[model samples]
Target: MLDISKLERRWLKYKIKKILPYTLLITTVTILGFTIPFVLSNRHSSKAMIPLKKDAIKVKAPNTENDEGAMVLEPSMHFIESMDTPSTPITNTPTSSTKPAPTPKHSIAPIASLPTPTPAIAQTQATKAPQPIVKGKLTSIKRDDTAFDIHEIEDRFKDTSNPNLGVYIAKYHYDHGNYSEAYNYALKTNSINNSIDDSWLIFAKALVKLGKEEQAKKTLQLYISNSNSQAAKNYLDTLDKGGSK
Candidate 1:
């Protein structure tokens, strides 16, 4: 019985040695199968999480020598940052309509026309002829056509019929340096026709030459106010400057 038990024990030991190696190998294979699939799935997931660029290209940095004289390439963060980002579409917002300001209206009144003067009033004004204010010997003399000679011309100037002829005679005498005769004739002409600018100018000039500067200046200023004559202004200037003729 003891010999049989020893044989059985030896056989059982041999079987355990052989089966243990096979059991360890099968357990390791099973564990590896499950771990390998899990690791592979994790790797795929991590690869999916990393962003991929369609236009990405490998860029080599400039070779730099290390202390061991070996070339090394360094990754550039600036180059990666400089890459273009995806553009977003721009949307335009709608605006509210604005109202225009109202224009102001102005009221305008029509101007009335002035009434025209009657013919009777005009005729009365025409009849009131200007008379000579200066009292001279020529103012009393009467014109005679029968005695209408050069000597009688000064006397004829007294007549109110034609004052322009008297003014011409006055200017002629003034041109010939006969200031006294010119003064008398100019006074007569002005008395007959005070509206004549030349008659007033010649009268003023003759008055200035005959040492009547104040009278000449007064007459010139009157004539200038009435006619606005340039010749009268010039003569007035000469009188102001103490100049004669």
Candidate 2:
């Protein structure tokens, strides 16, 4: 009544259906895990064994003659062979050929000899009339006689009441080494004409020459205020240094 054959066949079909799904899943997982890593490892090993192709560019090393310790890289044979070679030799020729001109030679003529003259002829030639030497009279120039007397000028100026004449007399006396006379005349000129800078200057100079340094310095300083006179300033500087004018 149990029908064991049919029951056994149903049990076998149920087990095959359940186990086939598990077997297919396990086979798929195993194949994925083992085949993927093997394929990746084989690809990596093939790449490592193969050589890489590089560009045929030539690299030149820097010149190291100036740098004694510099490292120089040697060029490879492939790099040398890749460089362009000359197909023909170059020749340079001038378009025109020039020849140098020859130098010219100058011919010199021989000098002629003169005949000797007789002693009588030589004496006659030497004795040919000597020129007369005329002596000129020496004229004496009297410079002192031509000069006008100061006494005469003083007499003439006594009649003329000219301040400039006084100034001129003062300068003339000062130039002639008469300091007392120059001082008197200069004082009179400056009193008559206060604007006469030359009179003040001559007065100061006469005072300095007469050994009156203090009076001369005072007179020059007073004159310099209105005139800004360089000579007066220089004279004052000389006095300050205790130097003679």
Model 2: residues with Cα > 4 Å off, grouped in runs: 1-136, 143-148
- lDDT agreement with native, every candidate: 0.52, 0.54
Q: List model 2 lDDT by residue over 1-245, tens digit each.
A: 89999999999999999899999999999999999999999999877655332111211223333323333333222211211111100001011113211111111000010012323223333433343433453322112210244454455556553665666567556655689998998898788767655567668778988999799888888888877866567657767887655
RMSD of each: 52.6, 49.5
Best by TM-score: 2
Candidate 1: C-alpha lDDT: 0.52
lDDT score for residue 40 of model 2: 99
Model 2, residue pairs in steric clash? none
Model 2 TM-score relative to the real fold: 0.40
Query: Per-residue lDDT tens digits of candidate 1, residues 94-132?
Result: 011132112111110000100122232233244333435
